[model samples]
Target: MRGDGSTPPRIPGPPVRGDGVEAIVAAGGLHNYQLELHAEYGPVVRFPLPGADLAVSVADPVLLEATAAINKRPEALFEFLTPLQESGNLQTLPAEEHIPWRRVMLSVLAGRPSHEAHFARFAELTSRTADRWADRAGDEPVELQKDLSELSLRMICEYALAGGLEPEEPGRVVAAFEDVLTEYLARLYQTDAPGTEDERRARAEEALTFLRATVDRVLAAYAERDDGPPERSDLVAALVAAGESPARIRDTVLMTLLAAHHTTGVAISWTLYLLARHPDAAERAAAEVDAVLGDRAAPDYGDLKRLTYLDMVLKEAMRLYPPGPYGAREATEDLTLGEYTVPAGTTIFYPFWAVHMNPEHWPDPEVFDPERFTPEASAGRHRLAYIPFGIGPRSCEGATLAMVEAELVLAMLLKRFRFRPAADRTITPIERFVLWAAEDIPMHLTPR
Candidate 1:
């Protein structure tokens, strides 16, 4: 808003012939659209989203402080995800409800006991995947995103289910999970018509049923285990212990699997892609991993903290290509940011990638420099300048788990192999609920 309590400058975007609707659609995706908008209109740009609603995109880290503690997400933007939840939408759950729900999630996801309990199994799955890649023909091309996505799905499934799933079950579960997301995303993106949508929803319904049944089987097995739920907690056991309803528990598990499948995998893929392109950085990461886990195939949970350079490389990759490109919050009350004010109910877009690229915060923002995250260089940076996981109370709860999973997998793979971009390939970053390669990230892997 202006000084006299008027609206802020109408952002300089494509003319409002259709409220900038056509232009937004033409700009490809919100990822590219926000990039173009911020470059032209400066840090704050108001642009049209899915429903022709004007949203303010804030790229400046200092300006973002006005919204750092907002706990509310925009209802309209998050409604698309409600269909996945029968009880309610996790993304748009009311603050009263979200607070407790987030607490439950954090306890399970961020718990050190949970990480310790699952670390061996997670490492085994990662080594198995890496060994398979090592066995492939030297010249055979690998789609890093596709392969890592499957591995991540299996890893998260085991972590969430806590050994309830049979060894053969993950492949089928991964297929069903992918099916459900594919159908829903088609509708969420408006890429399908009424008839096509109906069929897709039907398929999604079937896939959801399959997923719920699988979870039920796991829960039953978990209940019947002779060891009595093991010493460590998983998501299902924690939710069950909390006395959450069956539907609610199922929804939470489904949501976790849905959330984990792409994010952890994509983060690893991007990190590997970046490392492969920067051999000096890759060598440094490899050296650190080798030093930390000499003669071992994978790292012990305690070794994670010792692999410092690998952490920096992974953090730098996310800085360049965050798993999710943007996150939004709705103002519950009037707010002032810089010279402008935002009215209650206004949707404030946090374009994370743009925030990361702000010239004011990052000198040579386009360069992939891992040293940017070294403790000395990082100490002076604004806290929100590098929000790959997002901000506020609604930020990702699995951040600790994600970092552990990513660093361990990078250690396991980089210790045993060298990766290079496949010839004639380039990565185009696009938003699809998360930032993803417009095409699969193709690469060549050679055993060390």
Candidate 2:
């Protein structure tokens, strides 16, 4: 109510019409659509989103604080993920169940012991990729997304499964996961590719079956182990210790693999892409990596803390191009967002990309400046102003691990080579599961 005792002005937006798909398409993609939406309307805008009848998008970090406690995700928006999980859709799991599930996940993924335990293998894997790139340094430009995503998958496979699989198993596991994602994400975005709809669905189902069976195999192996349960740092072991059902365990592994790989892969790729475009920052980051490693190929676990500038560069790159561009939460009850009162069950969209670009919080938001992340500069900033990982209770459990992986990969790559954008390719970010380069980021590498 206003001072005059009238109702508050309805949140502004374009007139609601047929499912908002056409408008999203016209604006290029969801990320861009969000940028345009908030630029035209105020920070809080009510708009029709395809999956939800109507959604309130809050770009203001302060307003976002009001919605941070929401743990319920809109089922309709996450329904596409249902096929992959038998236990339930992990994305929209009810809070009572989700709380315990997240605890098990964090026990393994967010712990320092887990990161340290995995560091050697992570470095080895990253070094192997660096060696491959070094061999082809001048041959042809390397596809950053293609290769890095695969590397990230391998690293996560090793981390999540705890090396129970045979050498041949990782390759097959990566392939199966790729098949599942390619089909499902296509369905979500309605992309037209080579296969018929039935064919794609069939293939995805087959791949999903293989993935679940693979998890079962790992579980069986764990059961047969004579040396008691594996360590807490191991994801599979942690879940089993918590007495999660086989179906939930499988779902957890699948979701962890799904979440970890693409996001970390694209994050490193975008950081490299941005550095390639901004030579000065690239040079500075490289110099830092060189100084920190000091004739070593990669940094040890402890050395990661020293690469401050490179960390800033990675952060700013994510600010410019967040891996998961947006997330949604269903208001559990009536909520006040700034001046607007949102009713229960309303879909509240967290446009992470837009929030990062909000000029009120981030002045000259689009500029590729790493200094904005400096302690002095970041001092009084809103906490939610830079959520590369989504917000609050349902936020990614692997956030800590991801940073370690990305920084490790970036440190080694920057130490080994200087990357330059491929002359013939144009880099454009398109939303597919994760924010992906429409044409994979092609870069020519020069050995340092």
**Model 2 bad stretches (over 4 Å):** 1-5, 164-179, 186-193, 227-229
What lDDT tens digits, residue by residue, belong to model 2 across residues 181-255?
Answer: 788656665656558889888888898888788778877876777876577678887887889998898888888
Error of 1 at 375 (Å): 0.5
Residues 1-448 of candidate 1 have per-residue lDDT tens digits of 3556776644454444544545655777777788888999889877767642777889999999989999999887887677678888888889998998889889989999989889999999998998788778386778888888878888888888765677676677767766676776655456543456678778778887888888888777767767665344568767777778887887888888777878999999999999999999999999999999999999999999999889999999999999988999999998777766677888899999889889999999999999999999999999999999999899998888999899889999999999989879878886677888978898888888
**Top-scoring candidate (TM-score):** 2
Could you estimate the TM-score for every candidate?
0.93, 0.96
Candidate with top lDDT is: 2
